[model samples]
Target: EDQVTQSPEALRLQEGESSSLNCSYTVSGLRGLFWYRQDPGKGPEFLFTLYSAGEEKEKERLKATLTKKESFLHITAPKPEDSATYLCAGREKGGGNKLTFGTGTQLKVEL
Candidate 1:
């Protein structure tokens, strides 16, 4: 079975603080690693796609990296608007576009 797990269900950071969250997975074959940011009552907004070991993508204040078994999302100098649930999903071979997602790491950035 394909699965994804994220650590530290929630995090609180002050303005300008930076941190990284982890996502681990177990699957037959990894096709892609996806990162998304979701705010309250909103759907996830795509942030990145990391396809292979050592692959990485970055945008704004976030960076995402992938490996054979896991992926990481690093936040740099975040602001209050950066607060949201960060989700990590993976596509496994034969899974099609049906992504298996982690529970997500809820981030709170206080000014």
Candidate 2:
């Protein structure tokens, strides 16, 4: 069973609009939490990997943070280029490199 869950299955935003995406997980002994951006017809691009509660990573207008139970992807002043499906995954401790992924949240940014 999948241990990761993403909310709002879909999202729409106007250019320069900011929003946050949610990713809740139920993995036992989580080793790491990952965030990715997937464009149409392309594989997911890794954004961040948070390993502990309170950890955060940022690139450009995107920021990712992790907590004990969930992680969040915050988009600040997002542009249309940021439109894509956001995905989250968790690696189980001692479960090798296998990861459980959430279905992803589709995001659309309009002008």
Q: What is the C-alpha lDDT of each candidate?
A: 0.91, 0.95
Stretches of candidate 1 above 4 Å error? Answer: none
TM-score against truth, every candidate: 0.95, 0.96
- Superposed on all Cα atoms, the candidates' RMSDs to the truth, in angstroms, are 1.0, 1.0
Task: State the lDDT of candidate 2 residue by residue for 1-111, as single tens digits.
Answer: 549999889999999999999999999888899999999999999999999999999999999999999999999999999999999999987746889999999999999
- lDDT, model 1, position 35: 88
Cα shift from native, residue 50, model 2 (Å) = 0.1
Q: Which residue pairs in model 1 clash with each other? A: none
- Candidate 1 residue-wise lDDT, 1-111, digit = tens: 889999889999999989999999996677888888999999999889899899888888998988788999999999999999999988878834778999999999999
Lowest lDDT 10-residue stretch of candidate 1: 90-99
Off by over 4 Å in 2: none
